[model samples]
Target: MWIPPPVRAPIGGAPASDRRRVCARIDRLVSGGQRQGWPWPLPPSGPLGVGRSRVRPGALSVGMRRRRPGEPLEPGNAHQTVPPLPRRAPRPSFYWSDFNNVAREVREFCEENGLVDERRLPSATELRFMPHPRPWLANGIRRHGGWKRVAERLGVRTATDVLSQPADASAPKLRRRGGPQKPRHYWREWKNLRSELTKFVCENSDSARYMPTVDELEAHNRYDLRYAIGLHGGFRLVARQLGLVARSSLIMRWTDLTAVAAEVRRVAERARLPPDVMPNERQLRQYGPRGLVDGIKQHGGLSVMAPRLGLRSQRHYPLRRKPRLFWTRDEADRQLKAFIQQCGRVPRVSDFLDAKRNDLLTALYRLGGLRSALERVCAEMDIAAVQRQDGVKT
Candidate 1:
């Protein structure tokens, strides 16, 4: 009952020797298959050889050990699972211009259509984006002859549609040409005439009060006569008259007048006087004209009242009436001597007073009666010195 090799057996329906050989072959095939990394378990009907028989229709025993519940399975010698590849997006169509073809087509179209008449034909600039059917396709018919023709065609239809249908009818009309040139010379003449008229008006008017002298008038004209008059006269008729001008030319020269007016304003502002020396409304009402002392008292408050009262202006307070005394030259001299003896030295005078030596001396004499007093003191001192010398031992 020894079996032959699997190679000697037929595929199927073979003899016992063949069967034995098949069985031996199957064994050898299985062994070989295992070595070659194929699934095990040959079909019973097949010859015992590699790849000869199909296995059971059930889950094929791929020589892969079954994974236990919750157990990790070993990798088989099969192709790995791969993720599906991503799809690419389609590209957009682009249109490129062929200038040569376009130009040739345009020339041909112009020749064919008798559009060579410059006046009737469109300008080169207007022909931009002109379409040619031949370039697009030989038989492709272009609705527009060129850009101008297309525009014209569309414009007519668009205009018709607009006219037929109601819309916001207030859209502004299209201007066909550039606007008018600015009037430069007219403006220049107008300004010059205005200035000359302003001068004439200022000088010839008799109603002008405080007519500035020639120098004054020139100065005012240079700056602004109207403004000066306005500032000085405070809206006088003269100022108003100068400012008003009926002529366009005069009106144009108003800039010069304006400049003058500005200068006058500046001068007036600079010349403005300081606040009044009189008391404020509140103070005047509260104290009245005779309330100078009271007003001073109020301003000084109680803290400063004593010093203010002691001031020279307030000296009449203690004295019933201002004192007056008459003194002869000898009496004045004696008094001055007595005053010098009491005070020790004459008072120092100001530098300005010292510079006017005679005036300072006169002032000192008049104010203090020092001149006569000094004379009397000198006489007495001279007698005393002589007496003292006599008393001293020779």
Candidate 2:
């Protein structure tokens, strides 16, 4: 006994013979049995026969003519029996009807079984009979302006719906947290203290006295008052409000030293110095505050005072020397000898001067004059060779 070949299922899951019979019925229904005047080429079979004919690849048999490239399909030549081409999904339609009603059904279903949980939405198994079910529902809602709009039309409150509600503009904004509120009496005290401080700064601020130092303020018990003003804004602003010029630093005014220097110039003129010579630090020191010495040094030193008095002078500050090389005389000699041995000859004076070991060459010159140093090194090389030979013989 032989095994028969397994019958291949027809395209629509029917037997081949059954498919022929079905196609015959469909063809008769589609073309009304008399296809002589039909625009499309019919199957090459008898009027009522059930034989199926295959169209050649890329050659559609239509309108009794071969469809050529670039030729548009004639209206009457559309393939009535050919399978439809696979098309991509169309753009979502915004005018979907009954969106509210469909959404209502879904919302009711979710609420009925508490299936509204976003992390675990109701599965499609429960909605098997519904057309397109949850996926189509979501797409339709999205197409018709989002889930929030759908929820509003269905009279349901979803997370999306709640979030979509506009915030009330009339609501008061919350204040940012900060330090504790200052007491009412503390504010009153602040006003009075600031006024007094202003008056004090105006009276004391002058070219002669300038702003009081922190130490001086501490003596008068106004240091804490200054700190309080700083916490509110800063001392600079308070001083500015009082029409007092703020100094860069608390210790001294920029012009204070210049004024003192001016006084020293007057004293110098009285000292009978020649008109062309400005007084130096040693001469200017005897005329004013001892602190003036350091101030003079900072403001480009005593020479800076010369130009101001229309006198010519020059500043002379000490210059630093370069450090000495690390190598000793014996080490330098060994290095020089090794260099001469590698080079196959002693270096010329100019070559030695140009080398990194030029300092060593300078030392060699001092030890035994330039020409004499080369003679000594050549003599040492000969003696070392003789000693090596004697050691080998021993």
lDDT of each: 0.36, 0.49
Clashing pairs in 2: none
Q: In lDDT terms, how accurate is model 1? A: 0.36
Please give the distance, in angstroms, between residue 308's alpha carbon in candidate 1 and its true position after superposition.
Answer: 18
Candidate 1 lDDT over residue span 159-270, tens digit each: 2222231122332322222112122232234344345435655676444333333334454343343334434443334334446522222222223533423332333334
What RMSD, rounded to one decimal, does every model reach? 37.0, 33.1
Model 1, runs deviating above 4 Å: 1-286, 289-322, 326-331, 343-364, 367-373, 381-394
Q: Give the winner by lDDT.
A: 2
Clashes of each: 9, 0
Compute each candidate's TM-score over C-alphas: 0.14, 0.22
200-262 per-residue lDDT for model 2 (tens digits): 666654453244455445655565555666666665775555555555442353247656557
TM-score of structure candidate 1: 0.14
